[model samples]
Target: MQELAEVRLTAWVHGHVQGVGFRWWTRSRALELGLTGYAANKPDGRVEVVAQGPRAACEKLLELLQSGNTPGRVDNVVAEFSEPGDALSGFVER
Candidate 1:
């Protein structure tokens, strides 16, 4: 038998993410999915989200992030998949 591997999803959400409650929404979704990581705003006018956990959960979160939660107008989602850093205790908004 084989076990599923952990994954990390790093995403940069563009368009109306800042000042629109994106970070808090991200933290809520991530926590619901049982992912551990953080969400923060970049000076470049994007929202950075890092989620580490089961691959399926991470993928689902990615989809939600791209779907533009309430109060956010997500125009584009630039995402990347990589190995988890294994350093997150819980989902947070930074």
Candidate 2:
């Protein structure tokens, strides 16, 4: 079987995302997709989500982040793609 390429996705979620359990919701979605990373609250009222895993899984997570079905209203999502780094275990909410 051919292994899928791993990648990293850093998404900065904007709008009413800070105090609405967005990080926990993101962590749940990431874990369900078998991704590893963290969702942290930024001081600028944005939630930063970092997920690393298979390219497909990462994309799925990104989709979920902007699905408009999360804990809070996501006005916009700015995402960056890059190579995965370090060994990430479980998804986390920071």
Candidate 3:
């Protein structure tokens, strides 16, 4: 079978995302998808999610981020796609 291409997704989630378990929820989703990266709280009240894995898995994570089923209210999600650079292990919430 052909292997799926590895990719990285960096998403900035805005709107009532912090202080509401958003990072923890993101970590859970990332782990479920077998992805490796981190979900961090930004100083601007947004949550930044970085996930690296198969392209399809990364896309799924991005879709879930914008599905409005997360912990907090997500007004918008801005995502960027790129080639994976750093080797990551388990997902983390920061």
Candidate 4:
């Protein structure tokens, strides 16, 4: 079996994303899904993350973000491709 090459995604999670441990949850989930990146609380009450991993893993992560099960509004998710970075061994909260 061939390993899937990793891709990077920058996601801006909107709506009541702060004060709800969203970043932590996202990081944990991402790690479990074999993703590499960091999630953080934005100043405008949003969560921002840069995730890099297999294409399927990245897609799954996006699906999770859009699922609206993180104890927040998750009004919208703005994502785009980005250059891969030296992400942590596991997902992290930043």
Index of the highest-lDDT prediction: 3
For 1-94, candidate 3 gives per-residue lDDT tens digits of 2238999999999999998989999999999999999999999998999999998899999999999999879999999989998899899988
Per-residue CA lDDT of model 2 for 1-94, tens digit only, reads 2237899999999999988888998998899999999999989999999999999999989899889999879999999989999988899888
Model with the higher lDDT, candidate 1 or 2: 2
Q: Please, what is the TM-score per model?
A: 0.92, 0.94, 0.95, 0.88
Determine the C-alpha RMSD for candidate 4 after optimal superposition of all C-alphas.
Answer: 2.0
Shift of residue 69 alpha carbon in model 1, Å? 3.7
Winner on lDDT between 1 and 4 is 1
Residue by residue across 1-94, what tens digits does model 4's lDDT show?
2237678988999998898888888987898888888998878887898899887788888889999887667999999875577765777787
Kindly provide the TM-score of model 3 when superposed on the true structure, using C-alpha atoms.
0.95
Counting clashing residue pairs in each candidate, in order, gives 0, 0, 0, 0
lDDT of 3: 0.92
How does model 2 fare in lDDT?
Answer: 0.91
lDDT (C-alpha, whole model) for all candidates: 0.88, 0.91, 0.92, 0.84
Provide the lDDT at 92 for model 3: 92
RMSD of each: 1.8, 1.6, 1.5, 2.0
Candidate 1 similarity to native, TM-score: 0.92
What is the lDDT, from 0 to 100, of the residue 34 in candidate 2? 93
Q: Which model scores highest in TM-score?
A: 3
Candidate 2, residue 37: the lDDT equals 93
